[model samples]
Target: MKRIMLIVSYNGANYCGWQKQNNAISIEEVINTKLKELLKEDICVIGASRTDAGVHAKGNVAVFDTETTIPPEKIAYALNARLPQDIRIQESREVRADFHPRYDKNNKKYSYRILNTKINVPIYNEYTMHASNYLDIELMKNAAQYIVGEHDFKSFCAANTGVKTTVREVYSLEITKNNNDIITIEITGNGFLYNMVRIIVGTLIQVGTGKIKPEYVAEIIAAKDRSKAGPTAKAKGLTLEEIYY
Candidate 1:
């Protein structure tokens, strides 16, 4: 059997999440179902990240082993025919047998989008978080700087994750606003705990709205207490922008 890697992109509005679950339809379940129909073999894909429900992805990665004679490069085209319009395989290729999408990942970047406007645009509502207040981008940037480098991110992580360690290294965090009144917060790191990115965005939003000073972010990080951080941002605003392996 040959191991195949697939780069997947999807609009997560319709699915429960990336992982399969008995109670809800999920991206992983849909992909696996399509693969089975296309190759006529039962298959399941191992995804790099289990993105939260309603969270979109532009370049998520997954791998599956199959005994089909289909060309690896053409798998994407073939799979697209079977997948729903919301999900598409951007690229596919052969990989070493031992290469795993999750464990072999180098780093990942996620972007949280906020539509800072008095009137919410229906077209952009599915992917962007709507914030009515005027956000001070400069203040948000200043707070984001304190989040860079190694630190205990317990405050930013969702509770009940069961992760042994909360310490993680953040390579970069940036906030930018476009002319369309859309604000984007992009962050890159080696790994992340559950809801980590959303929490960070929530905390930054607090700073932008003057709920907290930029320098106060340092105290929150040092506290390592989840209660000290801001509320978790909505999942629909977050997108897995890219994955580096």
Candidate 2:
């Protein structure tokens, strides 16, 4: 059997999450089923990231072992034809037989989007989190400086995460606003705890809205208390932009 890696993109509005569940549909379940039908073999994909429900992805990664004779490069074409329009395989190729999508070392980039306006824009409602108040991006950027390094991110992680450790390294955090009244918070990190990125964005939103001072971010990190941080941002605003192996 050869290991094939797939770069998957999905809307994520209709599925529960990346992982398979008993009662709900998921990206993993859908892909696994389609792959079984196409290859006529039992197939299971190991995903690199278990993105939460309502979270979109541009290039999420998954690896599956298959015995089919189809060329790895052409697998994407065949898979796309069978996949729903909301879910597509951007690319596919053979990978090292021993490579494991979840255990392999990798860094990820995620972005959170906000529609910052007095009125919500219907066209972008599904993909963006709507915020009525005007956001001060400069304040958010200033606050982000405290988060752009390795730290015990317990304050940003969600409760009952069940992870062994909350320590992770963040490479960078950038906040920018465009003319369309869209605010984007892009973060690159070696790893993240559950709801970590969304919590970070929520804390930054507090900073932007003057609810929390920019300097207070350091205090929150030092505290390492989940209750000390802001609320977790809506999942719909977050996207798994890329994973670098």
lDDT of the structure predicted as candidate 2: 0.94
Model 2 Cα shift for residue 5 (angstroms): 0.3
Write one digit per residue (lDDT tens) for candidate 1, span 188-221: 9999989999999999999999999999999999
- Give the Å shift of residue 62 in candidate 2: 0.3
Over 1-245, each residue of candidate 2 has an lDDT whose tens digit, in order, gives 99999999999989999999989999999999999999999998999999889999998999999999999999999999999999999999999999987889999999999999999999997689999988899999999999999999999998888988899999999988899999999999999999999999999999999999999999999999999999999999999999998
Taking all chains together, each candidate's TM-score versus the true structure is 0.99, 0.99
Cα-lDDT of candidate 1: 0.95
Clashing pairs in 1: none
- Candidate 2 stretches with Cα past 4 Å from truth are none
Candidate 1 wrongly placed segments (more than 4 Å): none
